[model samples]
Each structure stands twice: as structure tokens, then as C-alpha cells.
Target: MRIPNLWVNVFIIFVLPNLSNGQQLSTKPLKLTDGQNGVKSIPYRATDQCMPKMDAKRGKTTYGLSFRLHSKGGHCDDGLLICYPGMLNRHADSLGFKVKGLFQIDNKKDNKVNQFCSFKMQKEGISAGQTHWRGIKVYTMPNGTENRQTMLEASVASRPYKLGTNVGQFSIHLGGNGTDLLTMITVNDGKAFIDNQANLQKQFLEQFWNGAFLREHTGLWMLGLDLLPSMKQENVKLFIARNCNCTMETWFTQPTDSSDPKEPELPTAGSNNCSIEFESTSEATTNKNDVSDECFGEKHFEIRFKNIFKKCWMKFANACPNQTELIMLTMSRRNGFENRMGIRQTWMNDSVPGEVIRFLIADAEDGEANDVQQKLEEEQAKHGDLVFLHGFVDIYAHLHLKVYGGFKWQQSFCANANWVLKVDDDALVHLRRLAYWTGKKFRPIVAQNPLVFFGKLYHKYLPIRNPKSKWYASKEMYPKDMYPDFMQGTVYLTTPATINAILLHSGQIDAFYLEDVVYTGILAELANVTLSDQKKHFKWRFDHFDEKNGECEDGVPTPFSIWGAEKLNVFEHQYGRMKSIECKK
Candidate 1:
């Protein structure tokens, strides 16, 4: 059976107290406005400054709180309580707040305490497991009433206590602990609590609603994540998803030198192994040496292989025509869905003649419907490389010429063209370096083994569950190591020869919903197409940006065509700032 929604979120809302400051004594109860989808955020000032009366070694007290309405009415229900402590946002507004530090509520409810979370923040300095607590609990309604009621509380055992304050607009996340005794007291419905702040304690205990109140206000559900400090250096990313709208942000303790450093060890398959295995005495000793060599050898081997392979692939594809070319083969008569915008934008963006461009627009059935035929005619008129075939027969791009389309073109054009860029309409492509990379040469660039990419053992790892996901797979259905360095769908490419080999072997490949990994990771494995390092492949919006330019460090080459942020104003401003330069040839 599937897990319920409320329970899943309970897992994501783990709470941990901040240990940097002395403990607080009479910290004012931050009235959380129920059902507002609010967030609570506070500044963490870590200084040598010590509290006068409290133990100097304990540090200063610092903390923040977030309030929200539970629902229109109230009820006896349970939810998760999460505390995001030790998140450092150097880029916080002049006042102080990091662009990063979003905490999420999982709501999968499979377990009250999760083994691992996508984002975890810890406060430690060069120590093994210093002051870091990543744990969750269950929070239940305080008292029975007609309206919403709040029941939650957290206590610090340290010398002094700290409370979080608001400079701009930020809210801390609070949910349930494992215990039944609720510490937080809810006041009036969210609005009243904000209005009558002076009498919060009285109103919350007296005017709070009961079970019926919560049931009626289904309210918008929200998700959040936080970045914390661990091992002296803080590297954390947080995300918040509310009402299906997701926003992710990242926070780093401090900025590091931007110059490239000597490469670190290559990521290993079992580096994330969470299992505890025991080996026999004699065998264990022998296995230790073997394991060491394999682990060390694998890391070194991967690094060397990547550098050598990247250079070779760049050299191999340098012989194509000097100019750029695009080929489109369409059979649809008319644009049936608004989804066609994906393809239409690409064709219109850079379809100049004498640029090795070609489109083989065709219709298999002679004008089956009005919409389909109209789309076909419109595209055919725009591009001279239009070809219409009656039946489902495979032909080259043009009627007589076998240029190629779909899987076949992977081979046909790649062999002759400098770069064979193929993309789906739903995707946005960044082509600044693609053209440049294609002109260089490399040894046969191949994909790593999908099984190895996923991990040494295929069916052992599990995905962290979330109530929002409709297609959550169980440990049984997806029992493989989450494939690392898998090719993403939407945008990818390789040399002409590689494409030819992939296309020629397409018949033997089975399709997977995640098409990119299936074709490139699985099928490409048969062709020896290993994973390549391309940091710009896929990324989220709030990941981070160049500190100076404010533009994404790895944004698509084109200004106006970059992905993320549908707001017209933001896109236009960013586009204007992204100075256009001719593709480096």
C-alpha cells in the first residue's frame, strides 16, 4: 500500500537545536501563523564574544522561530518538526540571510525518523561529529477547540538559550517530534494571531480551534531544505516546494578561492555505501589489501581516463564543415499541442542559410487531419529541406538523400557534420561550448557501464520518498544503485562516429522512461560510450550564480534562451547582461 501524504511530510520535518550560543531562559513564544505557508529564518553570529553571566565556553544565545496556521478549523493531528541549524549564508542581504537554506517536509511518513535526507546541515569545526543533530519528531494538536490550535515546544539544555529574529522576510520551519506532548501553543486563526500579537498566549489557549477547524482548511502544503556546516566547511543546499511550486536555494559557509585547484579524488561507487558488513578474521585481512587497491586504483584510473578522453573526443570531431547546420524532420500536419513551442523556438533562433542547416519535414499519411497538415505545410514553406513521405518507410532526411532523422541521424550527420545537436521541444539548449568541443578530437568517447554507473550492486539502493511524487517507486521495483554520472534527457551529444555507432545499434536497445540514461547509460554501454564530465548538462535555478555577474556560472550560452525563470523581466535583464560572443571556433 502507498503511504499517506501527511505522514510523508512528517519525515522531512526533522528538528535539531542550535548549539552555538548560551541557552535562552524566557524566550518569547514566536506565534506561528498557521496555514500561511510561512518560513522562519534567523542570523547565526558566531563570535568569540561570550555571555557575561552564563558560562563563557557555552557561547552566545541565538535563535529564530516561524509561525503558521494549521487550518481554518482545528483537529487532533500529527506532523513533522524540523530545525535547520548552522546554515551560513555569506551572500545574505547586507542585513544577513543566505540565498541558500530551504528545508522540506517529506510527508512520506514511512518512518518518523529517516536514515538520510537530501539536505542536512551540521555545525562542526574540523571535528568528527561535533555539534550536529539531524533528527525529527511528531507534533500533535495542543487542545480540542472549534478553530485551529497549535501544540509544539523545544528546550535547550545548554547554558544560554537563543531565539531567531526577522530582518527581512524569513520563517523557520517547525513540525512534530516523536513524542505526543505538544510544546507550541496556537493562538487565533493565523490572521488574528498576527493582529493581536500582544495577547498571543491568552488568545492561543482560549480562541484556538479544534479538530473540525483543521479539517476544513486543507491549506497549501509547503516543502523546505537547509544547508548546515559539517567538518569545518559548510556546504549545504535547501529547497522549498509549496502547492506544487518548487524553489531551491543554496548556502555556503564562506566562499573559497575561485581558481581551479588540483583535482580531488574521483567519486567512487560505494563511497555512499550505508551498509555495515562484517568479514571473518583471515578473509578480512586479505580482503583489506584487495579493497584498498581497488578503491585507490578506481579513483586514479577514472581521473586519468577523463582527462585523456576529453582531449581526444575534442580532436576527433574537428573536421566537419566550418559552419553550423540544423536538420528537422517532421511528419505532423499541424501543431497539435502547445508543446511544439520547444521545437519552434530552436528552429527560429538560428536557422540561417549557408550554415549547414537542414530540416526534413514530412507527413507519413497524406493530410490525415487539418491540424497536422497545416503544421507540415507551415514548416515546409519555412525550410527548403522539406520532404513528405506517404507511408511509414524509413528514408534519409530528403526524398532521395539518406541524411537521417531520429536515431538514424545520430550516425548519418555526426560522421559528416562538425556537431550534431539534437534536442526535444521540451528542453532548452545552451550551445556556447558544444560547437567548440565538437571541433577538437579525442579517443573513442564511450559511456561507462550503467550497472557500474548505478553502483557495484544494482538492486540495493533506495530513493528517499516524498508524498508529492505520484510515481514513487519502491525498493523492489527500483533496486539499483542510483546511477551516477548518468546522461540526462533533453540535451546531449557526441562525435559523429559515436552517433553512427549508437544509431546503428539502436534496434538492440530497450527504452526506459528516463530516456537519456537508458539510451546513453545502458545502450551506449554496449557501444562503449562512457559518461563524460559536462557541468552544464542539467542544473536547478537557485543552485548558485557567479558572484560578480549574478548570471548562472553555467547558464546556456544564449542570453534570452536560457532555461529557468519564466518571468519575462528577469529573463530580459539577464539576457541583456549576458554579452553575446561568437561561438569560439
Candidate 2:
């Protein structure tokens, strides 16, 4: 099943009860006015009160009150609570009616019957006499000064509970059958005021209110809540409000606001630059089972390369008991016979005693390219060095598939090799110097590091957009502004473990046209492999080969691997100049 690209938002709400250690419900009518508008707010009265002390085991308890508000003729605005710190032993009448607006009571549904008020202490450095109170008020105007019965008020004073630790941050972890949720809250130096409804539904509500202190930290809190089992398959919405200095600064509801920075930003529908087109012919449909079995089965190929390698091992067992330390995988085309021969005559023949070289080719499509397929089969039969990926097409766009198959082949047959170098058939390699460098310089690092990937590195490269260009990549193919760090495809080196990692992560990434970008850049990033720059070891174009110059100094420490070197004479000249020079230690 295709995964949908969606964004999610999450919030963390902390509820701190009043330090007086109790709850309260009041019905006495209290008048409040908006300082900005200078108009009387909603008519609400506190009905009940409870001041439960903080528990010794539990660090802090809550104090709250319930309210009964008179229904107005028109719609009622939301309620607000202004808190006064260090107001212990001061009743509502003795407090002198001066309170800083701290908490907001959001009556989004506009329910008119009852409202709740609660407050918690967030200040850590408060003295023993220092107490806090919540002055409750609503946002509705009085109804033409109508005379009504006085609202009944009740206040219950309970025994104080022991106070708990007053830390700056608190965290809670909830684990279920599936994913776990972590919630945390932190305040600077002042007290935190929480509402009564938040206290009641502390397990379910995920909201946060502005605290007393600011300016030091970002007030940044993170919460991860697991979705209900029933809601796991459905979309979820979250509301977020950022209030600055007791005023709502921003209120937004979005589907994709997550507090986790590590969460990968998926491509949204609006930002999707690539579209997938799937074409299935009758031949492909008929061979669907076979293809699936070949690709995903226990064996990844119909014709395995291990048998040929085993035969070669038996033939060379007397001469060399140990397997080759390095294997050069030269990607070749089905019809590039002369290019393969030129490579064999040049660097392939110049390989040291323990090193091995092989060519990789894929089978042609059904009912086409029969001549090229026949020639490939003949070449494979004669040399046994051609690793043919049966039931796969040899196309430029499917180079990733070829490389994947090669990785599987190496894992199966040449698992003991220290390093695997991939190059093109048209390129010439200075294998001797490469061998020297790998043995003398790179071996110690590779011995301690198995995840090292080395080649000519490219970073922040834009995709080719011209349709006529050979490397043109449409926006639909790649949407990012720059490709991830990747080694150039022409020449790159990987160890057995790195190859395994690349193969393991290949399925997680979308298949792209460029093999290097897909495998080395995308899959390598996912696999977390280390990529090193090897520009000194490989060059793209060898148009300027000067033996008298530093290019060939000390036996050409850098291998001259050039593109468009299909001519045998070019390889002969290049190899003749490079063969005699040995890298000076």
C-alpha cells in the first residue's frame, strides 16, 4: 500500500493546581471589565471552593472553583481568570480587585449553564506566606440591569496536603500496547496557572497556557500523544494557541504540527514534484509471479554468479587459497564487447596477483535485442567473468536495479572481499596505484570502519532540468533543491558491509533515474553510511594527461578514469604511460 504524505500537529498542556491545596466553587456574582474596551464582561459567579493541601508523595495538588453564569439575551464571549500571586489569607473582598490576567477559559461551544475555574502555582522560589488566587470573570454584558436573586456561593476549606518538589520541569510517560507518549512542561521563575476543566480531564486534554515568566527560554514544550486505536486509521486535528503576555498571540488548528524535530518532513500534496506511472504489458503480467519470485524470493536471481565464482575458485585454489581482497565491478552494456575487451587488455590484465575484476550486464527485454543477448551469452560462456543478471533489462534508467543485483551477487559470492569498486566499461582505471593506496593508506581506516564509502563526492548539486540533456531530471522525479551528498557514479568504492546496508535500504527509497543519487545519496543517507571525498583518486575526464606534469608524478597516485574512452588505442596510450610508474611511498 502506498503511504499518504500528511502533516500532523501536537501540543502539550500542563495543569498545576493552586498552592493553597484545595478546590472552590463559587456563585457570588463578580464583575470584570476588559481593560482595552472598558466594558463590563460576562456575568458569572463562583459557586464552590476547595483548598486541598499538597500531598507529600504527590508533589503538588490543585485548587479550583465551579461557576454558574446568567444566560444573556445575546451570545456570550469566553471567560477569563486573572491571578494574583502571594495573596494568602486575602478573601475576594480583601484582595483590592487588582489581578493580572493569566488564564483564559475558552467556551468554544458557548455553553451557558456552568463554568469552571482553577489555578496552580508554577513559581519555584515562593515563600511560605506567598499564596495565589484565581479571580474568575466572564465575557458577557449585563442584561439591561435586570434584578435577579443573588447566586448561591459555597467555599470548602480542606486540610492542607504536604507540598511536593517545586521543580522547573515535570515529565510524564504513558505506555500502552502500541506506541508510548511522553509529555513535559517547564516554567521559568513564576507560577503556572491551570484551569479546572484541565484538572478534570488531565489524562485526555492536550493544551498549554501561557505561564507567568518569559524571555529566558522559548517556552517550548514537546508532547507526543498516541492516537486512539480506533482513530489510528483516520486523520487527527489539533488546535494550538500561542498567548503572549496574557493575550492570545496566535491561534491555529492544523493537522501536521509536531513538536518532534526528528520527524521527517514528508512531501505534501502541494509540494509533490514527482508522479509515478506504471505500465504493465501482457508479457510482464504473465511473468509477474516469476519476476516477484526472482526479486523478492530467497534467491534473487535465476542465474546466480556464485557458481561461476566457485568454479574459478577451484581452478585457482592451488595458486591462491585466499579469495581476492578487492573486486572491481565494471558496469558494461550487452553490445559493448570491444569496450570490455579494451578494459581487459588495459587495467584488467594489469591487476595484481590477488585482485579480481568482473563485468556486469543485464539480460535484454523479451522479443527485442536478441542479437545483443546472444552475443552476451557467448561472451559469458567464453570468459566466465561476465556477471549476467537474468530476467532484468539492461537500460540506463534501471542502473539502480543492476547495481542492486550486483550487490546481491557480491553478498552471495564475494562476501569476503575487502572492498568493491564500481566503474564503467568505458573508463580506464589505474588499478596498480589504486591497489597501492587501498593497501597502504586506506586499509588501516577501512579496518576500523566498515561503513566507509569513498569516491568523487558531490554536494548540493541541482538536478538537470533541460529535457534534451542526457541527465535531465524532472521536478516530478526529484523535488528537492539539492541532492544529498553522493559519490559520482562513474567511480565509487564500497565495502561488503556498506554494500549490504545500501541493498537493505534500497527498498525504502523511491527508485529514481540516477543510480548514484538513489543509492549513494538517498539510500546511503538512510543507512547512515560515511561518505568520504576521493577526488584525488579518480578523475572524470582525462583530456589533459601529461606524463611530464604532476598528473603522472610518482606513478600517478591518482587513477585516470575517463569517460568516452571506448577506443582501445586510447586505453593503450593511457595504460602505457601509467603502467611503468609506481606510486612513491
Candidate 3:
């Protein structure tokens, strides 16, 4: 998953025809080596002044190719080809070689080119109806051979024939054995196109391999062909003139002991860029309307909350003298008095000694109901656990600020606690079980390694684009189709150190609509915090809970530490039933 810095360079030679002015072509081949952990990269450069001039009207396209090899034998079993337009300079000339090849499979009867090699353009962004490109293909081995093959490809229509610039940029990505011959072509338009016209090709070759060293005498070499523009017709010449740059990275894994031929290949999730479509959307496009005035204000958000928590801790120390081992912070709406009371009567009261529970409420926005603020103040006076954020508004769009405020509060006030469990007021939490897991089971791990986050996790989930959906995220808001690995928002667990890291580095990240994606995905990634999927800790639906089947009769479900019980009756029923059941030794 991670690439290393050391690399081996390999050289590629380009042969250019002599012009009327009599410039000799270079015959020496450029030599470069490959990198370790199955990675090969080559930078683009121009041999002479013959580099392509940037096109003013049409922008340049950048291409990437990734190759992955699973087994030890010298063959390319898996790969991907990616293309992005308008990513590079059009006029600059560089040094690189172009690659052209047929996707072939070795059949016992005959070796033939696969019909699936034809490239198709992929649609970008989250949308209602779009064609899904099958960018990955697997070919089973013929008769006696044990090896299988996989190939991925994508291409675009070439630009129209221009007088000055011929080729803009090209690169090759190769994986597996260096000797597994592939068809390659070389073309030179001469120094006239290079010097006055600023026309030359730029190409890069990157290769990734399995962990072991490949044999030197492997047979995979690219077959090279020469091209001349003068001999070809205008239409055919235009097609050949388009630039190609690709990144080829191959994942090489050790062989498995299973001998069944029908066994499925290992899942390659993040191996290629072909999985997600690239659009021209920027970060500012999606975040334009979502930016709050609170973000720009001079108030130190973290410092203000730190001061508030210090005062609350003093009050808590006088009321309850026991040192709290776990702090549970619930996100509450200022108007949701019923939900807060329902939580307090049921699960909030179930916490054993050495555990603390509290609600985080924010002020109502300007021009809204004044009665909600009056009720929150009364509730804070009655229940000493309420921590109110002063300047922030209690709204769905501003949830990131509220959550960050909670993290800062925990880090400042409850820094001695081993774990901080964040849950919503609508959810049902098995606090006794959570306390046992965090304190008795997971405490040693946190003491040694403190940057751990545990919760129900979402991986590679595409953003919802439907306007009617509650979680609609426009392309302008989030350009990528898939979000990074993030914890589910309903209930998740973290440590004091991770909370501090998120608070310290959170200024660098722009707040998005989804607090889970913003805090756990984006900010956590920037902070280098480790995320873990607690499969049994969080459940999306409570439909499976049946008292007859001892689901609620026992302490929650086997893996479910928290359930999304939005209704008060559902929370009370489950909590009452779980309480009646006896605990096993």
C-alpha cells in the first residue's frame, strides 16, 4: 500500500530521422532501473530542443497506468490505465517514450489479442444514471498452464492534425517480469518540429513488482515500431499523434496454498485509479455555500472550549470525587429535550462507577426560537452534565464545529480518561459493555499505542448526489466519488491523544457537511490517526433485535454495542430487557 523511495532506473532509446539540415539521431539507448516492492518510475525529458508547443485552444491530458502481479512467475496478471485531460502544460517538450500494445491472452490453440482491449471513456462524479466501465478483466490460463492473466485499458480519440505540435506527453507503466514482451512503437518528427515548432514526445515508465526479485532472463520486452508523419494520410496521422502517459504498478503477492482452480482472485480494492472517475470539480465549488461565518471569526474555538471544560471539571470534581475512566459525550439539539431525557432515564443511568456521561448542546441560531435557549439553560441548571457551546449554532450543517468542540472539551477536562465514546442522543448505547471492552480489554493497547480509533466504519462509499436524499452531497462539495475510510457518525470511540491531534490539525481541513467524513476521514487522515472497524460495536438497523430469540434478552447483539433506536419506547424496551438478563461468567 505504501511506496518506498529507493528506485532502479531504466533507459529507453528514441531514433529520429535526419532532416534536410542534416542532424544525426542518437543511437545510444537510455538505461534506467526499477524500484523495490514492485514499483518502477521514469521521468520525462527531451533529448533535443524538439518538444511539442502548448496548444492554446485544447489543453493537455495526463495518463496513468498501474500493473499488479499476484503470483511469482514472470507475467502480468492485473493492471489499470487512467487518463485525465487538462492536467499538464501543452507547449513544453520532454523526454519520454510512447507505448502501444495489444491485449493478448495465451490460448493453447493460438495466442490472440483480446477483443476487450478497446478503450471506453468513463463518466465522472456521483450521478443518477451513468455507464459503469468494466476496467478490470481476468483471463484464466489455458490447458496445462497454472498461470492466469488480467489486463485493464482506456483510451481517447486523438486530437486533430496540427502543423507545429505533434505529440504532447506519453508514459508507460509496466509490472511483473521485464521480459514479458509487449508491443511498443517509437516515432520521431525530426529537429525542425523540435526546435522551431517546439514539438517532441514526453513519456514515463513505472513498474511495480511482487516482493521477490525477478529473474534477469525473463522474456517480457515491448516490441517497438517506428512511425513517420509524412508517409501517413491526415486522418490516420491525427490518430497516431495523440499523447499517451500511463502509470503501471503491479501488486505481487505470495502464492496461496489452495489448489482449487475455481478459487477467486484476491480482491484489489485501491490498486488502480480506474475505479473512480476524475472530474474538473474543485474543493471551492462544493464548499462555497457551506462555509459558515463562525469559520472566519477571530474567536479561538478550541481555546474557548478548553476554558469552559476546565470550569466544568472543577464543578464535577466537587460533586463526584471519583476519577472517571471513560467519558461519554452525546451530541444533543437544544430543542430535543425529550430525546435527552429518554437517554438519561435508560442507558445514561446504566453506566457503572468510574464512568461519566454528559450532553453537548449549542446555542440556537439568530432570529430563531428564543424559548429553546431558555429550556437549555434550565436543563443545564438541573443537570450539571450539560456543556453548552456559546458562539456556535446547533444546526446540522454546523455539526463539525460542535463535534470538534466536544473533542477539545474532552482533551482539556477529561484527559486522564482512557477512552472517549461519542454517540448521538437518539442511539442506544450498552455503556456497561462498552466500559468493560474499553477499560478491561482495550485499555492495555491504548496505554502503549494511543492513536487508535474504533467504530463501525464505512469504506469506499460513494457520495449521495440525489437532492431528495437526506445526505445529498454535490460534486462541488466533494468531487471524489468515494470517501476515504471513516467511522460511522452515530457512535465511535477515540482517545485523548487522537482528540488533541484532530484539534491541532483541524484548521488545515475545511468543514464538510458530513461530520463523520470531515472529522474521522479527512482530519484523522491528516493527523495520521489509526482507524479500526469495531464490527460488533455499532449497528445501523435494529430490525434484527428479537427478545424471543434472546437478542435483547441478552446484553445487546453479539457485535452490537450501540443501536440506532430513534424512538424512546424502543430504547426503553431494549434497555429494560437487557437489564433483566443475567450476565454469564
Candidate 4:
């Protein structure tokens, strides 16, 4: 099965309950507004009467909420809590770089999130002097006027957050998984470290450190979102809130009844200026499978990264083990920070002998202007096992460019390796099992047949013309209604000759978006290459064609060379179970 792409991304700016005690960072400076005389503002820490919804139903924890400010009819408007800092730049005790904005989350579904928000603290509660996490007193019957219940008050304690950290839940945050921080501080970027090296989260948090305190620690009511009621539609407003603590002093921005900031447009069609839209979503999990693009219950597609091949700006010299028996080349997402790190720790654990595991991904989808580029740079220097193809981005739309781009790089750099095992970041290659079988079984087969192109092969798969479907292909791209025989990019192994053949014919054909068809099917057919089928050795469960819909489970047998794996946490969670299961005859 093909790896799914998520339309809605998960938030990654949260702190778990009871993990560690976070040190207090700053003190409250000045109040922009006085709520002392009935303005309804107070002081509250993430620890005080806050509800994390940890015990709530599974999938109940949402990360965003918005309501109108001082409007008629007391209705909620589509809004986002923007936690801004005093300045966008802060670090090394000097002025930081980058003009940052408040950490904001944009939730698409309008569900009633039970998460807390800033409101007037009510004295009528069973406890007399109690305030919510936002220092706003709870109201008895209902808080605020009927037309404006979920609203923010002006004070130094309104912690209006921006980015939601859904790392533990869905594994995406700030355009990546929290695991992307490489080496903490790198040898290239000059910066001091705490020496002992805290949770890589500290480095992750430092990305937004200039604009507000990201939730730290495991279980102390790590921040939740607020969902207010709505009356009607109107122009929305935004505020720059701050949370200063060491003593937990949260600050609120003075109310500015201005419309939301215009979202920046992303680059299109050869535009050099790439701007990552601030509204990238996570977790595109629909219940049923979206198999509109499949034919006869099978898929016939792979990525061919076109126009993405530029200069190799970031690379490791001879990182591919010379004359290694197997080379694992993973085509990963640019924002898949945790996936890359998870691969390094799991099956890529050097379990296979004479094999080198290297990840193949570009860093342009999320754009290099922000923290994504910095984290990638650090990860490469620290790991030195990554190959980031420069030039064009490797986005969902650039699938045609990334797959072939990876193979081209391998042909030029790591062509000496015997078997080029191409796989997706979401899939796990049982390195030990692969080695066991290749040496005892298929090694000689590939050694003799240098032009071997093998995997779960498919034939006569038709192109999907559904424009609404994620895998839609245009008639112009591939005029033929049916595709040629090809192997799935999920887990395919190719010899040096096959790689050379595919690259040689790359320039001869017109570029198409669907990668699997272009390279393995079209190009392989053009070069008169071999297409071997190895379906029984792999187990993939793509129940739903959802990117964040991971299928890693317990009690997996060790017989298969590859299993359908997804998500960062599941990879780590099942790594132990995967090792213990013995291959049954």
C-alpha cells in the first residue's frame, strides 16, 4: 500500500502530565490592562484548576478554540488563541532573531472542546478563593454576557497559546514531530548547552521560546484549548499574549479589534519564493478507506520527484557503506522529524549486517525559512546518515519529483551497494529478516541478475481521474488509461543495473505526477528492465488511506521482511514486540 498524506496535521506544542518539573523562567513585568476593578482578569498557572482532559475519551482532546470579542448576541466566532511574546527574538540572553508571532492553532471542526479558556473567576464556587488556570473566576449560572461567553480579558495572566503540541497524541508539531531536534546544539551553530542534554523537547521549545513559554513538564495541566459559543459572523480580532513565570506570570495583550492577519500564499509553478502557509493541518483520518484511486483492490503508483533535483547542498561523504550488501533508502516527509529519528532508533538499529540505512527526503515542503530548516541541518550533522536533495520541494504535489530524485542521488552516490532497498518512511524494513533471507535466499538471485526490479508487482492498474481524490491523475499526464507493470514503492528492492536503467530513460519520457507509474512501470518498461514480484514477504494493512491513520499493532510475526508501520510512537512502541516474535515456518 502507498503511504498516505495527511491533510490535517496534529499539533505538537504540549507538555505531558507529571513528566518533569519545569524550572520557572521569568517574572511578571507590567500589566497592560487592569482587571482588578471588574475587567475579569486574574493569575493562573498550568497547574492550578486546569483540566488537561487526559482522562477524557480517546480522540477527545482538541487543541483550538475561538469566540468573538465584546459583540452583540453573545455568540462565538471562529477564532484562535494567539500567545505572543514581548518580542519575536530571544536567546543567548540577547535579542533573538526572527519576528515571530503568537503561537496559534487553527482547528477545522467546530466541536465543543471542554478545554478551559480565560473567563471571570466566580466566587460562588464551593471553594471561595479559587481561580482557573487563566486566573479567570468561574461564573455560577454562566460566565460573561450571553453574546460573549468564551472571550479573553486584558491582564498579565491570559495564556492565549498559538501552536498546539500534539506530539504524544498525533506526533506533529510546529511543522514536524518533536523528535527532529538533532544533537541539541550542533558543532556548526555556536550555542551553549546545559551539558547534560535535557529532553530534545528543550531544543524544540527553544524554537518558540522567543514568543512565549511552551508547556514544559509531563503532567501539570499542560495547556488545553478553549471553545466558546457563537452568535453570528463578524470580522475577528487577535491579541499578543505572554506567559512569564519561574513564578507562572502569564501576560495578556491589550485588546485590538483588528481582523486576523492575512495568511501568506505559498509558492506555485517555479516560484523561487516558498512560503509555508501558517494553516497546515494534521491527522487526516477518515473512517473508511479512500480507495477511489485503486483498481482491482490494488494500487499502481509511486513518487518520481521531478524538478526537485537541484544541487546537493547538504550531504555526507561516502556515508553509504561501500560494497554494502543492502542499502535502505527511505523517502521521508520534510516535516516528518520524528519519523526519521524513530527509524534511526528502531529496525535501522544496525540489525542487518553489511547494510547501510539512509533516509531520502527534501526539506522544502514546510519551507526552509523557519525552524524546519534549522532542525534538519542539525539532524544531518548529528546523524550524518541523511541525504536531503536540494532545489524543489518534496510536497504532496511533488511526489513525481521526490521518488526519482532519491533514486538519481543513489545512482550517483551509493550505486556500489548491491541491493537498493527503497521504502517509505511509514513502512518498516525488518533489517535482520531481510539480511537473513537475502544472504540465504535472494542475494545470489540479485547478484547474478543485475537488472532485477522486484517487489509486490502490479499490472494494468488504471489511472484515477477523480479530481477530488488525493491521488488524482490527469489524462494529459498519462494518456494511457491503464498503467504498465510496476512495483510498489512501499518496499521494493532493485539492483545497480535496474537503478541505472531507470535513470537513463528518465529524460526520454514526459514527466508525470504519479511516481510509481513513471519510474517502475514506464521507465522500467522503456529500458527493458525486469520486474520481479515479492508480495508474500510483506504485510501492509492500509485499512484507510489516511496518513496519520497508523496501523502498528502488537503480536506481529517475524516472517515478513517488511510490515505496514506508521506514526513515530507506534514504531517505538512495537519495536520491542517486533524483535521478540520469531518467524514461523
Question: Quick one: best lDDT, which candidate?
Answer: 2
RMSD (Cα, Å) for all candidates, in order, is 26.1, 26.6, 22.1, 23.3
Residue 245 in candidate 2, Cα distance off native in Å: 63
lDDT for each candidate structure: 0.28, 0.43, 0.43, 0.42
For model 1, how does the per-residue alpha-carbon lDDT over 1-585 read when each residue is reduced to its tens digit?
322332232232322222244442332332222112213332222211112123344222222233332222112122323333322222222212322222222222232222111121211111213222223221323121112233322211111111111111122222112121111212322211232222332332333332122112111111112222221222222211111010111111111112211211331111111111321111112222232221110001010111111000000111123344433222222242233433344424544542332333322221133355445444433332233322121222112112223334323232444344443333333333333333331122322222211111122223434424533333333345464234444344444555555545545643323334445554566777555645433332323534244323234242222334333344334333333423323
Candidates 2 and 3, the one with greater TM-score:
2
* Cα shift from native, residue 278, model 3 (Å): 47
**TM-score of each candidate?**
0.31, 0.45, 0.44, 0.45
The digit string of per-residue lDDT tens for model 4 on 1-585 reads 311211111112112222224442232222221112122222322321112222122211111222111211111121222321111112211212221123222221221221212211121122212211222211111121121123222112233212111110111011111222111211111122222224423543455434433322211021222111011111111121211100011122111112221211321111111212222112222322332221111111122223222222223323455667777777788778888777887878755556877776654421133466667655655565666554444666556666765676566566788788878887766676666666665677766766777678887788788867766766656667898998776777788778777777666776655677777888888888878776655545433322232222232332444555567787876665555554333
lDDT for 93 (candidate 3): 16
Rank list by TM-score: 4, 2, 3, 1
Best by TM-score: 4
Measured by TM-score, how close is model 4 to the native structure?
Answer: 0.45
